[model samples]
Structures are given as structure tokens and as C-alpha cells.
Target: MNDKRASHGFRLTLAMLACVGAATLAGCNGGGDAHAQGRKGGEATAWGLPYFNMPDIVPPNVRQDAYTPLTDAQAGPPIDPIKGYRTEDLGGGVYMVGDGIYNTMFVVSDAGVILVDAPPSMGEKTLNAIQQVAPGSKIVALIYSHAHIDHIGFAAGVVKAFPGIPIYAHEETRKALAQANDPNRPVPTNTFNTLDVDFPVVVGNQKLVLRYPGPNHDPGNIGIYHPGQKVLMLVDVVYPGWMMWRRLGLATNIPGYFGLVKSMNARWDFDKLIAGHFQPGTKADVETQLEFMTDMHNALTEAISTIPYSDGRLNAADTKNSWAATRDWTDRLTNHCVNKVTPKWSTRLASFDVWIYEQCMALEQSIRIDGPSLR
Candidate 1:
């Protein structure tokens, strides 16, 4: 018994020594000469892969002093610091109100004002804007561009201001609000289910046409257009001068998003576009966004087909770990796609450096799943 116990202890000691030796060689805790330390103190595990030059815009997981500055065109008219919002006239009775970040529209009619989207960011300021332009004009109706909290979270405030005012939304928006059951966003009083035809809401002299182009940014996100003013308002889809919010504005359906942007101009004949963010846009802005989307799609598709799954970058020991291997493959693929578009796009779109990697990753995954079938 003593001999057997001694032999077991000796083997355990040898095993521990082997582990310590391996760790020392690998620089302890999977780091060392085998890792690249970022400027911000984050370390990227070495994959023995060719170095991918990061875009001037900071990549994720790294702290930076500041982001790329916005171009002059990207910056819109300044907002009043005290009021915390800005209002722009869209001609005729239609006017746009925004905090320079979140925007909504209101149309003043002979009967009353028709308020479109009450983003919580602008909250009471939305009502104040309506009052500023058309004093004593009761907000007769409220329209939700979509069911997103950022866009319509302040609907209840509007309803409170004008008791029993009809709230209009697509059936999907109503359903979503009903599910949420939040007091901030009241369920629509009137809901439209038509997908093909335009749903027009005429209040006194003002008329706003609502059209649902299927699901893009979110389900039931409809286009609100004023034919007389030649203005179109669509929420959370186009970013005007900026690169889209991360993962294509956190789109639930990427293919649908691509389709909507591609066909937006052809479908709506509008001089000014109220895209629910930043400054109002023009047909030229839509065209620029479409070009960016197309480049992203084309670049991702090419990377998906040409970049090998293994690519000789991943460590041999990690081969059996499917998740690790997949992660490495995707990182390489995203980097390749980012590098392809950085030259032209980095200078063109605002925050192009900020969300480009995420955009590439999103598109690459979409092409793999919701694909044109990888060639």
C-alpha cells in the first residue's frame, strides 16, 4: 500500500510540472509573445495569420481617445442647447421636429395637427414644437412610424395632452405594443392591415399616406408620405450621411433591409426624406446609402467565397473546438470584407470606421444563411 501511494504522488507531480512548463512557453494565461497587445491594453490571441490593418475608425473592444470627427456635410444645423431640440419647416403644413438625434414630424391642418412619431428623446419637446409652429392647434391624431421604443415611447404623453385622439399604426405595430403592455406606448386606436395599398389619413387640409414595404428595419415600419409637400418619412432605415447603426441598425431582416433601400427612391417621389434620425435627407442621400449597401453586400459575398474556412491561421490545437475555429474563420472573413471597403468608404460615410466591422460581420453571416447560395 505505501509503495502504490508513493507512485501515485510522483505521477501527479510530473503532470503538474508539465502544465507549468507549457504555460511558461505559451506566456501564461494563453498570452505572451503569441499575442498582440492593443494600444488600449486589450490583447488579441496570435493566430499566426497575416496582419490585417485596422481602419482609422476604432475597432470594437479597444478604448480610443475619440472617434473620427464628423464631416461638415454630416453635421446638420445646430440645435438650441436650452430647448434641447430643433424644428425645420418641410414646406406647406408639414414640419419636422428633432433633437438633432431623434426626429419626428407633425402636419398642421385646418382641423388640427397630425403628429407623427413621438420619440421619447424629444418627449415634451415634440408637443412644444407643434405649439411653437401652430399655437392652440390641438393634436387631433398621433401616428407611429414603427413600434420601436426609441421612436414611439412618448405616445402616451401625446395621448394625455389630447385625450381620446386617434392613434394610427400598422397592425404589426399595434400587436407589438400590445405585447409590450407599456403605458409609455399606447396601443393604436386604429390599425391598418393592408400591405399592398397605401393607407391615407386625411385630417382637415393635410393628408399623410402610409405604406408598408414589408419588414425591413422592423415589422410594420411604414412609409409616411405627403404628396403635396413631396416629403417622405421612414424611420430607422436610412441614416442619411452616417453609416448605419450597428448591424445595419440592428435589423431583424437584413435581406428585407437591402431590398427596401435599393427600391426606396423608385417607390417614393419625395424632395425631403424624414428618416427618423439626424437631419432630413434628399434623393441624393438615398442614392449614397444604396451605394454603400451595395458595396457591403458585394464585398461580403466575395470574402465568403474566396476566403478559406481554415485559412491556416487558427492554431492546430483549436481544430477540435468548433466554436473557436468558427470564430477565427469569421474574424478573418470580417477583416477581409472591412479592408475591401475601407479605402473608399472610410472618407465618405460618417462613422464609417465605427460600424464597418460589425456591418461586415452582419452581412457575411446573412450571406451565409439568407444567401444567394455561396458560390
Candidate 2:
């Protein structure tokens, strides 16, 4: 019995060391702690030993079948270096203007031009994009999809240039902007609370609908639908060809986010989807993400059920007194979920292996603590 206990202790120590090394090597500089549960609050360690010196986390071996191929859209024409942005018409006067990484929309109307979400990355390039598509047409309005500075911060610049153009956002967004007090992201001149679900802004033949599809990304994130163009614009919710941004795009409400994805897919009649991140997508792409998320949900459910809350090999006193047990359980559960889903999703979604652990951790927390509740 003594020899058996010693052997178990040694193996447990090695496993802990491996995890510490992986976390250290992986660089814990990610957005937030696992589940935003306020960090482990000590020297972040693996098995009570300092983990900073450990080697990086080893990714699971990529199966030949799990490789994600770049679609034609992703490999589409490079942004013109000279122009600094590319403007592609999506028919009916709606245009997708990308300054390489981020894309926004602009609709040409008889009265003037309407711009949606002027990302700071686009900078002066946004003005140049508008010039290429609708020359001499003044921007009469600016639509903010959400209060995220990355997406709507440049609206301040646009407002300065086009003065008096109405800035539109959901009531939740207006409140968020006021609290954030960011100079770059000015509060909206027009705000809509729960009373207004569908707010339409008509610019000649161009009709843009601003909607609060319940809080998914942030409190006031709104969706922009251009019915005339058969295009629906929402940001940070779905990635067309890639795995979702880390932590399900850092969603505040996980179930709400999932619900939004399902509701949006069924509710809209548009052919083209402007997810406001990666490549704009088709109905098929939206369905692809939905399928991937469903698979993740199922995988997490299984991991939660089969994985023991505490590994028997762990030191009982250490497990009870320290972060060891929680850490051990999370490591085991995360790997289990990763093994189950990565085989199929890695091949279908870009960067699946890169961010899958964080994705699983976030979902596991939501399932356990959030109690399957939707607010």
C-alpha cells in the first residue's frame, strides 16, 4: 500500500508539472481568466510549483482530415495597397468596404450615403472607400452595430467630418457609451430602448433597419438589415470561415449568444450575412457556425458528465485546501472536450485548435454556474 501511494503521488506530480509547463508556455496573457472567475489570485502555478518557466502548451496532433482549407472568399483578391481599402458592390447600392482586416458597409442613396460602423482600423481609408463607391455623396447618417470601440469608435471622426448626421444605436448601447466615456466612441444622438425593436432609417430607395436582437455581444449591440440589398449586418457574433473569437467572442451571456445565433438564422430572409468580422458569409456559413456551436455544446455536456470532479490520485488535503482540485478537474475536462470536438471542427473551422481550449472552458463555466439560464 505504501509503495502504491508513493507511485500515485509521483505520477500526479508529473501530470501537474506538465500542465504548469503547458500554461506557462501557452502564455496566460489571454483576455481573462478561465470563465472570468477572477483569476486564481496567487502566483499562477501548476501543482503548487511556479509555472512561469514551463514550456508552452502542446496542441493536439492535427489529423489530416481536420485541416481547414481557405475558401475562395478568404483567398479573394488582396486589398489594393495603393488604395488601402477594397470596395465590392453587393448589389442594389450596398457595398462591402474592407481595409484589409475589418469590413463595414455603406449604402448609396439618392439623397446621400449611409455608413455602418466605421472601425478605427479603417481610419481615413473609410472616407476613401466611400469616395470610390459614391463620389461626392455626403454621409447623411451613421449606424452603430454595437458600442465596442473597435467597431464604432471611428463614428466620432465621421461625425466631425459630416456634422449633424444622426448617430443611431440601441438604448443599451447609449448607456454603455455614457458609462465608458470614451472620446472616440461618442454617445448616440438617437437612442432606442426596449420600446423600439425595429428602427428604420430611409435614405431614398435605401432602407436600413437597426434592431436590438437582445444583448449578445454587449448591452446595446444592434443588427443592421438592408432589406433592399438582402444583406443582414451583425458583428462579433459569427465568424464566417473561422472558429469564433476566443471565449465565444467574449460573450457576456453565453446562452443568450447561442440563442441569438439560432434566432437570427431562422428570423432573417437575407441571402448574404455581414458578420462584421472575418469574411462576409452566406446562409450556409451561418448554418455552419450553428452546427459547430451545437457540437461544442454536446461535447461539453459529455465532458461534464463523465469527468470526475476530483481526480482520485490528487492529494486529498491539497485538493481540499488549494486550487489544485479545481485546476485538475478543468485541465481534464478541457482536454476531454477538446479531443471530442477537434477531430471534426478543426478541419471545418479555421484556428479551431488554437482557441478551442478557451472556448471549452468558457462553455463549461456557463453550463455549471450559469444554470442554463437566459436573461
Candidate 3:
């Protein structure tokens, strides 16, 4: 990795050059010119990468309405992001629980209410969200889509908030949590202890909530849908293009994503989608995500099966310019400027990422048959 301080790559260099190349060259001679330079400098401060492949890949987050990224003058794991919370009214005692950058939600009643994603930092915040949403109402159940830290980051929080609040997680989730607290924890808290709640599976006006796992983001990953309300909630399974959500281009599990889409499309009975992060979403986005997943899978499968590599390095002619190039050169470490930017997610997701990358390298080999493209 580059040893330069702050944002790495020439993108920042481009930004700085655009900021005052003219004024600096004009010399620091006069006050008026210097004042003009000041104005130019002020205009230079803007968020986001100045140069990315797609400007519209994800919607840009506005300052006032989105999670503001904190700058790190130092380097470590990618923990620059700190999640905060807010709520969006979704009518009928329902809401979109927003963590500034991502979104979570709840539906409440006197008996109990269902929650999407655990509150961050144990129950201090989850309990706080509960109190804010339906003060005094019991959190009858908690649902986790996957084991990503941001998704169930506060499972402990829920446990603390409501004590034995019945939490419903995918079967695999049960395993992850059961061993989450080991002293020699593997890959952080990838596993955890769920509330051991039983739930009913239903679709389309069916009151029964269901659990299904196909591709395995975290063994316990599944989607939550309310038949009557047509509310479908998923976490890492889908992320919206927004300021808070990171681009999954090179970070996601393409093959696992494909299986995930296939699984979701084959089953489930809802129309609205409340993804874990980015802008509020719809079922169409899920479908689109499916398509992308499939594309990635097909691309990777071909590469892996056909590409020829030796000594652990792919043959140059077979993978001239493709995802293989990136994977081959990916930094062995994802040192964040702060804490590990990624949360203590299920080992399943990690497994998926690994699978996807291996296949991606294969896909790179497949594309090599066509010769290198402008990477």
C-alpha cells in the first residue's frame, strides 16, 4: 500500500491540483488575487472520490441528511465510520430505523414488536430506539438478515434492552452466536448467541415470518417479510447506492450473491425491500442485485474453470486485464485508517467473500480468451 498520508491514490492529487494550481502558479503576489485563491480553495472542499468508474453507481449522500464521514489523520483498520441513528415514519406504527448511513426498522404493538437489525453498542442504543419508537412496548422479537456486525452489531444490546426478548435468526446464525464469546475468537465476533426464538414462515398477507438460507452470507442469513404490510427487510443481502454504504464492486461475493438472488427470487412473498444500508429501496432493486450477482457468478465460473495458472500466479496471457488482476494484487491486509471498518460479521460472509474472489480470478481467466480490455 502507498505510504502517503490521508486518502490514497491520485484521486486526491487530482482534487488538490484542481483546487489551486492556477493561483499558486500565478504567485502569492497581491491580496485580491490571494483572496480569489481563498474562494477557489473554499470551493475545493467536497466529499467523495473525484474519479470513480461510475458516478451514478450509488447516490451521493448529502451533508445534512446523511452520515458524515470522520477523517482519520492516522492509519489502522477501516474504522473511520461511526454509526448513528434516526427513524423514518412508514405509517401504521412502522418505521425505517436509520443509522444515518444505513437503515434499520421496527413495527410495534402492545404485546410486542418486530425489529430489524440490532441496535449498535449493545442495547444502550437499541433500547433507546425501542423507547423512541414505541415507548414501553415490548420488543417481542428481533430478526437478523446476516451476521455482519452492522446488522446484528447490537445483539447484546437487544439482550440487555429487553432481557429475554425472543430473537429470531436463521438456523446458521444460531451456530455463529453460540461460539461468539470464545477468548480465542476467530475473525472477531463472527458468531453469537441468539435469543433462541421460534418464528412462523409465511408470505403475502400471512402473519407467519419465515427463515430460509440458500447462499449463506452468514449461515443464519435470511430475509424478513410481513404479509399484511408487504414489508421485506434484508441486511447485507442488499445495500443501496448511498453515501454510507461502501461500493461492493471488488468487495462482494459474486457467486454467493448469485446464489442469494436465485434463492430470493425462487421464494419469498413481499414487494418492499428495506436494505441494511444506503437509500431506502424496493423489490426491483433486489431483482437488480440478483442480476448483478448472476453476472458476477457466470463471469467468475468461466474464469476459474478455464484459466491456467501455475506457481499460484495466473498465466499472464490467460488473465491479462480483469478482476484477476485486482485479486492477484489485492493488499494482503485491509488495514483501515481506524478500527476494522467491517463489523464482526458471520464467518459465512467471510467464507463467501473468499469463494467469490477465487471464482472472480477464474472469471478473469475466462475473459482473457478475448484478450485484455482497458482496465
Backbone clashes in each candidate structure, one number apiece?
0, 2, 17
lDDT (tens digit, per residue) of candidate 2 on 121-236:
88879988888777877999888888888888788899889988988888888888899999898888887786326788888878998888786877777778998778999888
Model 1 Cα shift for residue 105 (angstroms)? 0.6
Per-residue CA lDDT of candidate 1, range 1-375, in tens? Answer: 698766655543443343334433433223333333221122222113223333333446544456679977788888899988898998899999999888989999999999999998889999988889988889999999999999998889999999999999999998999999999999999999988479999999889999999888899999999999999999889998989999989888888888888888999999999999999998898899888878877877777788778855467889999998888788777877787888888888888878898998888888888984223
- What candidate 1 gets wrong by more than 4 Å, as runs, is 1-57, 373-375
Ranking by TM-score: 1, 2, 3
What's model 3's lDDT at 214? 48
lDDT of 3 by residue, 1-375 (tens): 656533443444443444324423432222344344434655323332121111111112211122223333111123223434556676656677665445677777546777767635433555666677777766666666665665667666565656665556665665665667522111222223333232563212224364554444455666666656667676666644321123332223434444565556446666566766544666666665555444544444443444333223344564766665554433111111001211221121222222333333433433344332212
Model 2 residue 205 CA deviation in Å: 2.6
By lDDT, the best candidate is: 1
Quote the RMSD, in angstroms, for model 1. 9.4
**Among these predicted structures, which one has the highest TM-score?**
1
List where candidate 3 sits over 4 angstroms from the true fold.
1-84, 119-123, 182-208, 242-256, 294-375
